[model samples]
Target: MLGAMSSIKVQCVIKEKNEIGESPVWEEKDSSLVYVDITGQKVSRWSSLTGQLDSIATENLVGSVVPRKGGGYVIAEGTRFSFVDWVKRSFSTVAHLDKEKPNTRFNDGKVDPAGRFFAGTMGLELRPAVVERKQGSLYSLHPDHSVVHHFDQVDISNGLDWSLDHRVFYYIDSLAYKVEAFDYNIQTGGLSNRRVVYKVEEDDGIPDGMCIDAEGKLWVACYNGGRVLRIDPQTGTQLQKVKLPVQKTTSCCFGGKDYSDLYVTSAYKGMDENALPKEPEAGCIFKVTGLGVKGIPPYSYTG
Candidate 1:
């Protein structure tokens, strides 16, 4: 079935800008949203019920943050896998990877259905659109505290999601401008049979963060494209497009009580003083509603 094409509304819910706001997850437990700011070095949470926002300062670039079933958050901070105690506002490192490569850091990540934390790394961003290519890899953190290296030679590991039946894994290497799928093993948390599921056009911008909705369609945030695309994974066709006011729409995830609201994150990292004026809402968090679709609940890390 095709996705909705109804007119949607975009509202800026969070006005305080994040240098690079990414990795947004709906924390259903507390009725809040959790996300990270890479260059800003912070993990933040915005309460939907109370209208309060809280942030914890990190020592290095914090890539992603996901709720842990063990009663805290599992985060990829720099190259370390750490546990975050949000209430006390602290985190402790559990493991570290990528020691051989000094410039790489974790980028975007998510939890698989079987509860493994999957995150990938990227080379240092020397400047806008310029990064050390092929210096990164994707890793899986099992519930047992063991890390498995999935693949290497990645320029920018950006987005991730899974199929409805839990048999397919979808991912994005931002620099590749495409989305790939792999045969997923729910029992073993292994992936194989990698192939392209969606090829993004150059005019649509680089595919960043993504999530799957209830209808099995993929919603992809287009960095530098200023839009979110709803795609039919089976046919590799664009079904719907939701435009945003900001040019650097970094990532998006469905939230709200019924998961009908699409929350989008944007970035102003590359915008200079002259360019920033044109896009006044460059770094704000926006909520897109009235799409007439709902998203499934995101999985929390079992580890």
Candidate 2:
């Protein structure tokens, strides 16, 4: 079944059923989509035009995957930031964190406008929805291969994107149920003047991965709400919404020839045995079209 948006068409593009699918990145070079399967411990690249999907398995939980400016890709897995060699299908650690907390692991992340990779971690997940502590922190990996700790005590560092002017950084710590913006200094990679842009009501579900459109509006994925909301950051008003057949809409990115297509990721990790039967497309990747909007290209990690 398609979503409630009558004018918008939502189709399942990938039916691989990732355990915990997150982080969808559009690779314009090859017209492919790159994403991660956290609990599945792998990064996958799928060609929407050809329907060819290739995956590289990692040794630990892989949270996010983004293209590197030099080559291959950068991944946030376990407690470290690693480089994924596309040709060799291997990983090389570049930076590590949370040495003392064995339960914490890297989560959602993305590259900034300046090519710095910003990724964060989450506390121990006792189960699908039960996260234990707030020991996770947000960090940035510079092009020079240096890691900078931005802040601490983040429960689930998820969505991240910078404003068009590169002066504001938008982020989401899922458990907070709100979107926060920081005054960003592009040159120094510094953040200040943090403020709330909008709040995600409990009924709407936890806000997960996010992206910004050319119009400066935000597109946020509602984890258990089965919807993607287009919100105006300044007024906290919902401009539009695209519903999905599945509930766990993890993350979203703009792709396609003109960057007008919205690609969304989902998960089936915590669904009960009985509940899983009803949502057959829970772990699939969806492509939403007819939205009549274009998105900005994502930045790659220069390092």
Candidate 3:
């Protein structure tokens, strides 16, 4: 659908194993690569300076993690949200997302330009549910322990990123194969002017986690497609792509010194042991080069 299966020049920066590894965010200041093992409920950290990795222990069914206001991190576990001081080993539950519908769990999420956390939920039915059109929604977590549901009934809430200017918000609905956009109100935490910025054709792949570069372009991971696609946000045009040897790419983020080293993670969760040989590379961390755009620095929680 998009192109013939191809390979890009990149290596396994980190070889440690993982399950459903996703949500990678490059911490520019620390020169550390941060990501989450969704199913593991653990947050991982890899230092490029030392090439070592350490994990924070947690049991929140974590979907995403970001640097917190003063120190530590804000984690989204299932539908429960909490703040953790990994350094001190203390954690506090900030809010419960699905008090009414306990079956829903938080998926991909990230911090907005204002340092507020935004996360989304998927339909309870593995299949698209009634919430798909309106109920399954994206939420905003502010510094005050407040919450806001921005959109609803999403089939698969996979990835999200913001434009360099903080004026545009981009998000992916995995099952829909669409990366949608909205005019963002940074101060108000409001999203308007909904638009279809990019739609993946069947051949490309299912959209997973995403990151925005300094140029406002979107780098989207193609889950089953085993690759990533670079798209121009303004025109909804596909400009370039990087193919992975694996079959399921979960997420990606720009890391390394200059933000040129793109780190990616894959998943082997759904595959049966019989199908394991078909995707031996499935759950390994990967890297790529010459990925032109530099990603925006992750926002630190101030609230």
C-alpha TM-score for every candidate: 0.97, 0.97, 0.90
Least well predicted 10-residue stretch by lDDT in candidate 1: 1-10
Model 3 Cα lDDT, one tens digit per residue, 38-122: 7776888888789899898677567788888687788887787788877777678898875425666777889887888998877
| Model 3, runs deviating above 4 Å | 1-8, 98-100, 124-135
**Poorest lDDT segment (10 consecutive residues) of candidate 2:** 1-10
Clashes of each: 0, 0, 9
Question: The CA-based lDDT of model 3 is what?
Answer: 0.79
- Residue 237 error, candidate 2, Å: 1.3
Best by lDDT: 2
lDDT of the candidates, in the order given: 0.90, 0.91, 0.79
Q: In what order do the candidates fall by lDDT, top score first?
A: 2, 1, 3
lDDT of 2 at 202: 88
What are the per-residue Cα lDDT tens digits for candidate 1 across 60-82? 89889898997879999789899
TM-score of 2: 0.97
Clashes of 3: 9
In model 3, which range of ten residues has the least summed lDDT? 126-135
